[model samples]
Target chain A: MVFNYPNGKKYIPAAKIEAAPKIKKQKNAAYSNRGMTLEEDLNDSNSFYLDRNIAVIHKKPTPVQIVNVDYPRRSAAVIKEAYFKQASTTDYNGVYKGKYIDFEAKETKFSTSFPLKNFHEHQIVHMKAVLEQGGICFVILRFSTEEEIYLLEASYLLSFWERMISGGRKSITKEEVIECGHKIPLGFHPRIDYIKVIDYLYKLS
Target chain B: MVFNYPNGKKYIPAAKIEAAPKIKKQKNAAYSNRGMTLEEDLNDSNSFYLDRNIAVIHKKPTPVQIVNVDYPRRSAAVIKEAYFKQASTTDYNGVYKGKYIDFEAKETKFSTSFPLKNFHEHQIVHMKAVLEQGGICFVILRFSTEEEIYLLEASYLLSFWERMISGGRKSITKEEVIECGHKIPLGFHPRIDYIKVIDYLYKLS
Candidate 1:
């Protein structure tokens, strides 16, 4: 099952779109940037870091399978038919002060809990492999209703995912997330200022 | 101008495609995999490294700007109209054992020299930033005719690019490339074992 979230153009299975208990069509739109504020903020923050020569992280481009293309005589070729391809890795990754950092930014409208279905099975696997390879991996979770964001390590998220796999709660309560994740304060210059959290957690600086 | 080489589709400016003194559309067809063997090879090699728990490198997906989409009921969303966007960064980048690894792979069929036009000005600027941030930056240059691949440090490529801006030679002679870069031997499992070259260059081992 492909969880297409790139460019905010989701091609998710109908059942997976609102896996949360009380999610509605309008609730998803209430969040900033069509529920992708975390991504945009991270992009702004990464650009800030790159400009300052602090980090070199970038979001991977939206993956698409090109089916047909029309080459105009003297203009750019247009992709006529294409489908979103399933991403095999986490969305954001790069090197920070000689350390490998990888993570995914996810925003949820749920007030009390972050739905586990927001993540895919393959992403869990990818996160595990990244950690095994000694890469720093995590997820930037934004709870829109709470106006809170957290940088939760992949290992913690993976364990919660495993619990759900063996028929546990389908979501993690916000309290539990707060217990494990580093709260990211919003800023003006870098916007999210996630690198500060990374420096603190990884002791890079 | 955007060089659309991700899917073996050419969206190059007409003049830039045949920048070499002696080139035609027929000549581009001579290279393997529709002149995208280098990208394919690197992907294969990256997978090998990931599976072996060695490195966490990945090629960024081809960037596309989606203009229109059709979300059918209970069916996958289809991208109806899209266009290739100019890539701001080099194609491949990831973390390798605590080092940021970034690179662009270009295959040139010209026997005498590797054309500098295979690169872009922004890419040169990006390579410089990556270097300043202490990242491992380079280009994987494959001379299709010589059956040789070289990992030339981005510093060298950047110098050559600057010279081109001041009306120097538009290409780096094959002899100069051999002298400055490390020749990567083709391997069976990883296809192109570029990490070995990086390991030696950075003294990682």
Candidate 2:
């Protein structure tokens, strides 16, 4: 059967059925076969934490600017028009054991260096503000090539940002990150397990 | 001489011209100057807090889903089609004095009672999650007629919400709010001095 989308695009179900097995095989051939993206994994981890009453961290929804809507029925309102808007804050924030935790997640394909452009100016400003208010702020950096991760504190990020502005370094080197940040081991159940890092940081602080 | 809008409507100048004093008096009488709405006042107060670095709170931008946008030459992007979307989180949150503060601001025109319908199930759920995570969560209630404002903690709101579900009070009475919530005195510097209430709650907790 064929299903037509709102944009008049023809969708074929039989073709998708035929491709599903091959797509699954290809996906298994890829790294780890974790069956999820970084976003999905983190979301699941957050849910696990919430269920256990360990912490309450949430990924903020994408901001969109809406201009029109149509209500065909009394109960259903369909969005007819909208556009993505720039987010003014970090992606994730919540309270963990009486301390505020705020952070952004980023993934990089490069094994040697992560590009600085992945972080926006507003995110930097937000991190700085959180730090000034004595909240624990950090960024979770994932090197997809190496399948490794690190949690870099916002203070270190601010220093790198200032250095970039002063023409010192265009981006933070992998060595520098390894030296300054905490290495987070990949886990089976919660995936990132960043709360462990938070615990460590809290104890250290 | 006259200027017309794109819709061919007569344009009214915001500035007052040197007309006859009698005509000016008549024009002033025609318009009811009720001053700023509660939302506007709160927005101004939030901006004041932001400027002073006392708090980092912001009203989440109206959610929108855009279908079309026009980028005119030498002009900003014009959203041609969009629709408002349901927000999954509360309207306002920030870090204040080493604490994570989250809240929703609501206004009621009713003099005697505040309607429970003003809040959504999703908002209540979100507030509950934040509260469970040890974040300071609350709601700001503004009574337009009385020009009174109250800051009610999430615990109180949840209690009232439970009563609503159990066939108890359908709405919170004005007197109940005045008794249970902290009365935020309108001030000159930051306007809504909610931090005072936060300090008190912090101490109690």
Candidate 3:
């Protein structure tokens, strides 16, 4: 008996691309001048960790609400109409050393403090859920101008967030973050290398 | 100073769908008669688990490579050209009771046996990685014709897959699955409560 898949490959409902257009590799002098964003650094670090068979963390794909699709002849299906959907959880999550690791990375251009406004209420609630489940949840805050990175635990952020909602400071002071969070020195190969900090924070637990 | 996001929200890159067209909730007689597909059942179960705060499992969004995006209005950005990219990991993964749970779900109409071809090599490799990290990894097989669902451990599937590649049976017999795999009974509320099986299997270990 032959079973036909009318909607070929139900697992991957997205359009398949054939003969991917070659990307022109033109180098720009200013390309290296632009520092890597927190996302890029974390992606590079995740790849590095993955390649070495160290962990299985991945950045969840951006959610898209597809409405209309066009299947061009002999080529990939083109998404003619789609909209982005809000993420219900943090950006990055995966398993490391038999423990679940989850985190969100955010960059702040502010010189003195990180604004709590940058994070959404839903994200804080999601982090709370992760913490309740015994998963390691944290936020990687990148002080872009200062080129400093810190890993702040979800518990620390939760208290401050609750305080803010209760008519407290709207932002987390730089001094408070420095006191509460762990500093992660930047590395060349893994870029952000947040796993080292994970090791420090969650290895015992 | 107030900083306004010209793109209302930068965190969620997807476009917001305002005044979404009515879904026209017409019930198709055939759709209801045809038992819920594996994907739908799992989605329902995940929602059930999430609503009760019992677990936080989610199906990863399909990955798409966006080529052209059109900002037709100030409020929404429309994806004009995008292609789906192949996934590197299993479909469903999340933390449950402090343990990392990862699994793939597939369905076959064959009543006698479950074919191994439904799974990809990369997915098997991914399950291996998850296992190595001490995470729970498995496959949920749905025999559509028989209306039976079985939860087979990654180790069991790996053994059968290796046997097939080494000049053995290309499929796992229904009897074998029944003997080696745990049967997951269908439910009304949670649909496919595979967590119940997980609790029975891994709660102690």
Candidate 4:
């Protein structure tokens, strides 16, 4: 079961099993076959960047509320009871080349369109705040079907989200994303060469 | 009972009163009278700075491992079983004046000295990593006695920590802290005007 908060994105319970067979099949079908999930891949890429002194972006630790703990002798403390807490901002943010970099990463199987509903209202609000502060804000979208990645600026995202609210476009078409975003070519040393895109944006800004 | 991991910081279980009374009292005494803890004050200050476009800094969310979650109708998802996860980096980090700023805040009640025990080995390693990447890393120490605050650079901390391992000094002397650290003058608008100290360091660097 997934929990939907008013301001934030939906929370998919990591441990919950769906009762509906159709939905379960869909969820299973959506899972990537890259050996690691998108989060893990990003984390690995961040580590790679950090190791090479390319950039210092990091995924924020998962928020949790603690209730009980056990202190066992000669071992690490064991957490007895805790709960997941809703995050107030994006998953990844850091500094690079004296610029504040903020971004959210999402993966989609759709070859032709990316859903706007994947983003939360609070996230949009946060991106707006970052933009206002002169920070570089963007999103990394991975189209698994085509094995293509794109970096779309927060400004474009804001416009799309606003349009969605006014009953305009429900999702951003692949063609529009291709035109608006910089295609991020995957590389070996650092699998996701996002800094190159940042460099490109830096020059434009 | 507090949990102590093999390679992680020790966590004291606040709910386990019967475990150790003296330690509990000490911890409580350290935080007792402060209207807002250092972290809370810094968070408020960060929000103020971000709103004004003066600076950008944020505290990373607390790490939590979710085990089980229950999705009940019409309410926030309840996390049934979860565990606290050790953080891999500092609590607060961001960009200011094109410099990467990273730090950990700690409070001690001792009037004469701040115990080395308050700092963990992992934190030292993490600070070293930040420093190697050309980022500014420091610790904010709150001496509860005289309500004084100090921003001690990671270089100074690493030197002191090394000395402690060699049995030189168990804790940093209050006099040494005052001499080495940049004294942060408190203010009304931002409360803790740490950026002033950052400015000093920036000039020196």
**Native-to-model Cα distance after best TM-score fit, residue A152 in candidate 2, in Å:** 0.6
The digit string of per-residue lDDT tens for model 2 on A1-205 reads: 1111222122324554343233223332334465566666687788788778888777765565433345677534444433345677888887776677889988777788777888988789888878888889999988877888899998998899899889877778899889989898988878789999888878832
lDDT of 1 by residue, B175-204 (tens): 989999999997888889999999899998
lDDT of 1: 0.77
Query: By DockQ, who's the top model here?
Result: 3
lDDT of 4 by residue, A78-174 (tens): 4455544555678898766556778998878899998987787878877887777567889999887777889999999999998999989889999
Instruction: Tell me the tens digit of each residue's lDDT in model 3 across B10-109.
Output: 3432233322211211122222345445677788899788778888888887776655566667646666666666677888988898888899998777
Which candidate, 1 or 4, has the higher TM-score? 1
Ranking, lDDT, top scorer first? 1, 3, 4, 2
Top-lDDT structure, candidate number: 1
Predicted structure 4: lDDT: 0.72
Worst 10 residues of 1 chain B by lDDT: B1-10
What are the RMSDs of all candidates, in order?
A: 8.3, 9.5, 8.3, 8.0
Task: List TM-score per model, in order.
Answer: 0.84, 0.76, 0.83, 0.77
The TM-scores that each candidate's chain B achieves against the reference are 0.84, 0.78, 0.82, 0.82
How good is the docking of model 1, by CAPRI class? acceptable
Candidate 3 CAPRI classification by DockQ: acceptable
Sort order, TM-score high to low:
1, 3, 4, 2
Give a tens-digit lDDT track for model 4, residues B47-84: 78877866678788766555455556433444454444
Local accuracy of candidate 3 as per-residue lDDT tens digits, A54-138: 8899888777766566666534566676666667788898998878888998877787999998798878988988888788899
